[model samples]
Target: GESVGLHLPTLSVQEGDNSIINCAYSNSASDYFIWYKQESGKGPQFIIDIRSNMDKRQGQRVTVLLNKTVKHLSLQIAATQPGDSAVYFCAENIAGRGGADGLTFGKGTHLIIQP
Candidate 1:
């Protein structure tokens, strides 16, 4: 289920700088987590993901880290660019709950890029 917040938390970063987004989940039974990037007027796009069995995974310009003990997840974007400005969301999937379509999302965090 999509969890919406009254106000979206925000992070500001300079263009070309690295940006780190953090998220925390409460379900210990969740075995998979994914980070998504959603530009205005569009749905979330896949950024990176990490499984419970793995602590970290890297994509083109993104990295996802998982801390099972804390039920925390984070996404690191290297060399942030203007196009990176968007709302980022973290979703958790409980084991056997479903596949990608069954993810439960957190209130998105808005990433603001400063030129």
Candidate 2:
């Protein structure tokens, strides 16, 4: 009956600009967070991740920021391109829970790149 994650339905950004997607998770006990990018007809791809002990982490062109105090998380994309257009979701994993009980995912945010 409890919600695990939260997400915005859509996000629009112009080509070559930066994009920031936000998520709010309900599980304070969750220790791991991951950001995924899913293109149409394709499986979700790992973009970046952060641990509960860390507040921020960065990948090639992406950054994941976690705010445990407010159960907020965000993904930042630098110089977003049309190729970056897709649905992005945030997943939270509780420590010691694995196998069939996998990470809980957010509803996802559809990112549109305006030409």
Q: Which predicted model would earn the best TM-score?
A: 2
Number of the top lDDT candidate: 2
- Candidate 1 yields a Cα-based lDDT of 0.84
Candidate 2: residue pairs that collide: none
List all candidate RMSDs to the true structure: 2.8, 1.8
**lDDT: worst 10-residue window of model 2:** 1-10
Instruction: Please state the error at residue 108 of candidate 1 in Å.
Output: 0.8
Per-residue lDDT of candidate 1, residues 21-112 (tens digit): 88888777888888889999998898877789899999998999888887778889999999999999998888766458688888889999
Report the C-alpha lDDT of model 2 over 1-115, residue by residue, as the tens digit. 4445556799999999999999998887898888989999999898988888899999988999999999999999999999999999898889876432588888899999999
Q: TM-score for candidate 2, please give it.
A: 0.92
